[model samples]
Target chain A: MTDHIDQDRPGRGDGAAGDAHRAKPTSSAFEIILPALGERPAFEVGEAVSVRDRSPIGHYRVPIYLRGHVGTVVRIIEPVLVDNEAEGYGRNAGSRLHYYRVAFPLTELWSRYEGAPGDELHVEIFETWLERAQ
Target chain B: MTSVHTDHHDHDHDHAAIEQVDRPGYYEVMETAIRELLIAKGLISAGDIRHQIEVLDSRSPALGAAVVARAWTDPDFKRRLLADGRKGCEELGISFYDDTQLIVLENTSEVHNLIVCTLCSCYPRPVLGLPPDWYKLKPYRARAVSEPRKVLAEFGTHLPDDVEIRVSDSTAAVRYLVLPLRPEGTDDWSPDELAAIVTRDAMIGVIPVTIGGEAA
Candidate 1:
């Protein structure tokens, strides 16, 4: 666990680095049809979301890079019983909230991103950390 | 380097002269003390610990590969898996050792999904076994969520600029798994043959599963 994969493996990087005009792929998305939940979700799919920029001390699940960023809600995880912040302290007696899968554009995530316009980064953010974007 | 003389060829020389290493970290010492104390108090037996570790070690990437292969061939199973990753795997007799939920992300030409634990190395341990050492390290945890396209390039996965590189950060209770796109020239292959090409990196989303890729 102490070892790092910072360096590339001994016999890898076959696709080569820095190859412009990459070949177009033949396959499409796997396209899994999601069943609807009777219970209403906090935020609907495709809704714009803004992550709160709260700087809480000690154990927290929200990554610093994602704080105060706007994204779209990809999926809503049901049952809403995760308070990993409190659970990390060995106790989970606090109120629960849903963990919505939010998809942020890679360009918005990193300023120097040179990938395609459709590229994105998704993260599971608790309802408390997210609010309806203006 | 030791100079070998032909006169000493009759005796077997010990080339493996490395010293016996001990648990050197503070947590390692603490863990040893607590474990020994617990054993002495008859709380948990050494056999129990060994059994748990064996169970963890036995869980390789093949389990996830099998699920991917099934999804490729069995449309009904794939539908159930995307809806509920835990239940779908459970139907296949894959037992989840923990309570965390597993979210299976489907990869398409439009978007490629990658999993990362920015907060820590949280992974789908029940199916994919332990996370790689690099996965638990600083570089991947930091770069994957930020410069994801560049990170994918490190693994030799050069996707078109139009392809959406979706990086899923396992920051909370949910664990993410990428259901990679079934490569071309694999349509005629059996479930077993398809599974043979589905590798750990493809599942992890660092690389796509190629036609003649190494099996997990």
Candidate 2:
């Protein structure tokens, strides 16, 4: 079941890209504040962690299938741009969160997965949506 | 190549009677009207719009291909790219349009990478141009997240069964670019020649670059 039923409008070539690009000046502010904070990522690459099960009522990036599943952090991307809390509303009030590329087993996400046992999918999750694995 | 046509139409029929069906849609008319109105109100200039159009037109897969070629030939650049993608791209004189960070995912003999935007078409437009219509379609978005291997197969890409497929969804502001493994037999090739063989799909991780041939 997909929640993307309202994305029917078609016309490419970066209309949203124009709206968001260079429009927010806090991006540079984030760059200056990030190093000063010296904040370390919560999870390390190859460490097992579980996605937080919080279901917010508004727009979010975390897919529904990955709400409570365990995954391994495959990569730690640099802290840049605002999180969903700010991006969804075009506001620049939230702090930058570390983005992690977590790999999850396809079978774990779907019981009827048809791929091999080695098959897996990765999703970019913010530090706020991840927790230590149980 | 051969041209095939239906035989139902008679050659003697009046071809001049055909009507021209080309016309702008309602939204297009509205867009032009709004643009003209904005220009009239001094909110924006026509030159500014032209400049913005030129900026987008200047971006394409060639920019990304050049970056990959540099990383392939220079070990230090590859290290820089893997360590910090945005900085590495800027080292090559590529400008960043926004604050979004670019992440370079390297493909190896054991691991493969594929990128998608499940929420909306949030892509690295500064490097790669606008995504293809198929990439923006609903089918590709949903299927890529659910069954990436099958989606690759649909694109005529087949990897070894033993190799691992890592499908990374571009769910946020970060954009991912796949650094495909350098093809064999290109040891003596120049960066320009190597870059020519790299396709947009290869950088997207749907297919691999052919060593001595065209797009693979």
- For this target, which candidate reaches the highest TM-score against the unseen true structure? 1
lDDT of 2 by residue, B134-187 (tens): 778889888887888898988888877788887778887678899999998889
- Write model 1 residue lDDT over B35-92, tens digit each, in one string: 9999999999999889999989988999999999999999999999999998999999
Q: What is the lDDT of residue A71 in candidate 2?
A: 96
Q: What share of the true interface contacts does candidate 2 keep?
A: 0.63
The deviation in Å at residue B206 for candidate 2 is: 0.9
Q: Which consecutive 10 residues in model 1 chain B have the weakest lDDT in total?
A: B1-10
Tell me each candidate's TM-score: 0.80, 0.75
User: What are the per-model DockQ values?
Assistant: 0.54, 0.44
DockQ of 1: 0.54
The regions of model 2 sitting more than 4 angstroms off are A1-38, B1-46, B212-216
Pairs of residues at least 3 apart in sequence or in different chains that clash in candidate 1:
A5-B134, A29-B108, A116-B161
Candidate 1 lDDT by residue in tens digits, A25-65: 22333221121332235577788989999898897888888
Q: What lDDT score is found at residue A66 in candidate 1?
A: 87
Q: How far out, in Å, is residue B63 in model 1? A: 0.4
Q: What lDDT score goes with residue B58 in model 2?
A: 92
